[model samples]
Target: MPTPKPSILIQLDSDPQPSVFDGVVAVDSGVEHLFRHGGVQPDAVRDLVYGALFTRGPADLQRTAIFVGGSNVAVGEAILKEVTKTFFANFRVSVLFDANGCNTTAAAAVLAALEGAGGVLNGVSTAVLAGTGPVGQRVARLFGRLGARVALGSRQLDRAQATVEMLGQVNGGRFTPFSTSDEDSLANGLAGVQVVVAAGAAGVTLLPEQVRRSLPDLKVAIDLNAVPPLGIEGISATDKGIDRGGVRAWGALGVGGTKMKIHKRALQELFTANDIVLDAEEILELGRTTLG
Candidate 1:
């Protein structure tokens, strides 16, 4: 048999950070010949990606897959789309777009929501806080695709509407956007909702404890803010994947365990075939495989 094919992952970044280095480690779980380079400019990504493709041995290159990730989700997507047009059309290669672990992390969080809801996502009313952002958008999309009535919440009504439109395009109009800029609006958004996820910016509290406690119909509340001033109030940073109150609550760290698992598994999946594009739907399916 031929020597085991070498694998490589290219992390596209606007500004390099240490967190990216950790992300690389997770991606390298099943990959070989792990090489990293930064300072990727949108206008020049084609040649840069081409260089990585051709410089390595042609045989090893066949097993190679590209993973695009960065903090700037919109910019990262623009670059990845361009890269796809140039590289995928001309060459045979597998690639994935997972800016800020958006695909995998969102998949894990949604899986947690399903698990917290007794392994059923159909007909569930799930609320996604800060749903206009990258991760939040992916979570909303996944929830919509899984047959849940998704409430996409945002501080700006227009932004929420735009997000709902975008997600609906992918999910065939299954999500409804809600404005949660104030206490009353947030309370209204949470009304009759069974699942709540806070994917807002770091150091911001999107849902307060009283609101969480008042939701008698709530089944699970997951906070994806790993920073201080947790996204969902009353969720401790150290919370494990456990049940709390009448509703099961999960902090950022609580959901991270599954996120990391999905990330590593996504890397392994890149080598399963030469044509797989591990987007949100694929990532969510991978997360489901790991669920008990």
Candidate 2:
């Protein structure tokens, strides 16, 4: 038998320290050699990508891949764009962008919400709290793509509208902006919605226990905050599938296991082909396969 090709993953991070979460997942996904670079700016991507391209021939290029990650999705997206610019025909490596694990996390949360809402997302009204944030925006987009009538909520109405507009432009789905700065507004925004997801910042409570329990049409609620206070009140970090006030509820750790599985599966898929680019839609499809 010929010698086995080496499996190498180049991790490019925008932060000063590479993400420990991403590093651990890469190793768990069967990457034998991980080359990590921190504080990687968009300007420096070409040289770094060139290094990976030149070292491997076409047949073995599949063994190498790139992962772009950072705390900021915008910066990570820019880096991903620059990385793609360096690739040409027959000389490209598979790449994935998970900045702050937003893509996988969002995909998993949406999947969990759908599961809680009785396995169908089409025509279901859903509200995403903190919709201007990276994960919230992704969740909104994914839900809209699946035919859910998505209301992207933010503390600032302008921000929510901007995100809704952006998602509409890219995903061509039904998305509306809702101001959720206060309980009255949040209640109004969530009115008649079947699913509510709190993807807000750490330690901030987007939905109070009483408010969540009072939503008449709410069938499922998911909180993606693992920090203190939590995103959705009365939900613990480890809650997988629990019923609260007649609504199915899931906490951060509940959705986290699926996210981790999706991330690992996406990484493994990179080695199956040399041209796979696992972004939000591709990663979400991988998550869907896991459900079946």
**Model 1 C-alpha lDDT per residue in residues 155-226, reported as the tens digit of each score:** 998999998987777889888888998989989987999998899999999998888888899889899998
How many collisions per candidate? 0, 0
Which candidate has the highest lDDT of all? 2
What's the lDDT for residue 157 in model 1?
88
lDDT string, candidate 2, 1-292, tens digits: 7796889999999999999989999999999999999999999999999999999789999999999999978999999999998999999999999999999999999889878877889999999999999999999989988889999899999999888889999888599899988999988888899999999999999999878877899989899999999999998898887987788889999999999999999999988877889888889999989767
Candidate 2 lDDT score relative to the true structure: 0.92
TM-score of each: 0.91, 0.98
